[model samples]
Target: METVVDGTGRAGRSGRRWRITSMQVLCALLVLAILGQDLLREAFDAPVLQTAATVFVAICVQALPFLVLGVLLSGAIAAFVPARALRRVLPRRDSAAVGVAGMSGVVLAGCECASVPVARRLIGQGVAPAAALAFLLAAPAVNPIVLVSTAVAFPGEPAMVAARFAGSLATALIMGWLWLRWGKLEWIAERALRRLPDTEGRDRWRVFAETARADLVDAAGFLVLGALVAAVFGVVIPGDWFSSLGEQIVLGILVMAVLAVVLSLCSEADAFVAASLSALPLLPRLVFLVVGPAIDAKLFALQAGTFGRAFALRFAPVTFVVAIGCGVAAGLLFLGGVR
Candidate 1:
């Protein structure tokens, strides 16, 4: 009887493993099938494909510089900066720190995924949890690389680029300020947030290696999830569906926000998606791209993993409303011509 019970347990475990493996295989096959379809190959023959390729490449090229810089800066911060020094430098007042920290994105250039380790490091370094949170929220959208790629993607519409940057900054600043004022920092932080190494400095190379490796491992799941959803959206949705919905910016923004939750696109690459949204008004798409880095389905997963699930539920909606508002205002101020 005992032997039979053991056999049943083994079978159950095997079945579970098989199910997981089967799902992974199915996901891979789906990705390949979509790539094989005209949605991907059509780019080779169609001028629109050329535009898509241009947007993708430009986004990648533009983003790499910022990714490199942010990673390096994070490494340096980890290596040389002590927790006490950081705490002393950082304002304990959440509103002030969060507002100022949101603007720090102008200095660090990284996509949403790349920003995680840097944010974790900042939190670990005792830079006020609110400030670290702000950096995580703002770093991806408010960077030069994103700005440039967006400008190039929306050629002839320079205002779209400006709106994206300005809107992102405004939303991030507001959220950061709020986080400082009311955000439960303790609930979000892991035990590492409190640990202080006796050593003030570590070897730079070692710090870089450790941070990059740890971050990639920890955050790669979110990236894969984001990429999978983006790929799926490219395959499943007709490129012009948003255009068919009409020229209403508010409606389009709402729809895009829903789509953002599903697609989980990296902020660096989202402008390409936004540019492809030819039918959606410029402001709505800009809002979509700006808001996405802070609150997407996969990014929510990443946040839950990094901080806690409780934090994400409260944080996401607040950021979403603020982002859309910023985008709308930016549009009115800069894109009156965009219907």
Candidate 2:
């Protein structure tokens, strides 16, 4: 009987060791894709398929650099910046810290992919969750890099850049204050709250490298998924949707807002995508830019993984609603009633 039990335990251990991983499945799929390249080429002969492929490549290429930069910065902050130092820099009051945190996004330029891990790290390092959350929403949308990209994308409409900045900043500030008022600490995962060991000398650099690598790995898969979804939607969504929405302002805003979440375009690249939709009025496009970096499918996933599903479920929907309202208000103020 003992021999039988030992044999069963051994078999169980062996089975666990041989269990398939997501990475292995991905590699197998990649190999099959490479082997069937000719078939894929033929399949992509359809205009819709070709368009989807183009969009996938374009989004991946455009966003990856910014994503990389964001992770690197996040790593640096995690490694070099002490919790005490951060505490000293921000106001003692959470409400005041929220505003400062939102404004700080102007200097700390990064895409939404970078913000999740960074915010989680900040929370772990003893920063107020509200302040960190504010930074998460603001960094991607209000950063100089994103603003400059918006300006470049809409050279003829300088107001777009201003509107985007104002809208995004407002969303961050409002969310931060709201979190301060009602958010419970228990909603965040214990893993996110656990502080990293403080390291000195060469160990800090090692921490930086490890943190950045882990963050990149964690976030990149979701980024690819988001790009795929966006690409598929790009082809599936008829061109007539844009042309017809011009006359239906309310419908246009709602559609564009939903598209923003579904597309999950990088904050830096979304301005260009919005600019390409010439058929839509300025208001809907502004909503697209503002809503995207604040809460999208990818961002929602990142938040869920980093902060906890409870936090994400509550936060994402509120952010989406806040972003739309802020976007509309900014559009009216800056674009003069969305002309």
State the C-alpha lDDT per candidate.
0.67, 0.82
User: Model 2 reaches what TM-score against the true structure?
Assistant: 0.79
Q: Candidate 1 at 241: error in angstroms?
A: 3.6
Task: Tell me the tens digit of each residue's lDDT in model 2 across 1-339.
Answer: 122336445522223346888889999999999999999989989998888888778766766766676667667766787545655688988999999989988977666877887787678778899999999999888987688778876888888999999999999999999999999999988888999655555588888898788767755665576677667656786778766886788888889999899878767667766775666899999999999999999899989998889989999999999999999999999999956
- Tell me the deviation in Å of residue 45 in model 2: 3.3
lDDT of 2 at 180: 98
Residue by residue across 29-66, what tens digits does model 1's lDDT show?
Answer: 89998878876575467665555455445444544443
Best by lDDT: 2
After superposition, the stretches of candidate 2 with alpha carbons farther than 4 Å from their true spots are: 1-16, 19-23, 110-114, 120-126, 152-156, 182-202, 217-235, 265-269, 272-278, 301-313
TM-score of 1: 0.69
Minimum summed lDDT over a 10-residue window in model 2 is located at: 8-17
Model 1 residue 265 distance off true place after TM-score fit, in angstroms = 1.7
Q: Cα lDDT of model 2 overall? A: 0.82
Show where candidate 1 strays beyond 4 Å. Answer: 1-93, 189-193, 196-203, 206-240
Quantify how close model 1 is to the true structure by its C-alpha RMSD in Å. 6.4
For each of the candidates, give the backbone clash count.
0, 0
Could you estimate the TM-score for every candidate? 0.69, 0.79
Poorest 10 consecutive residues by lDDT, candidate 1: 10-19
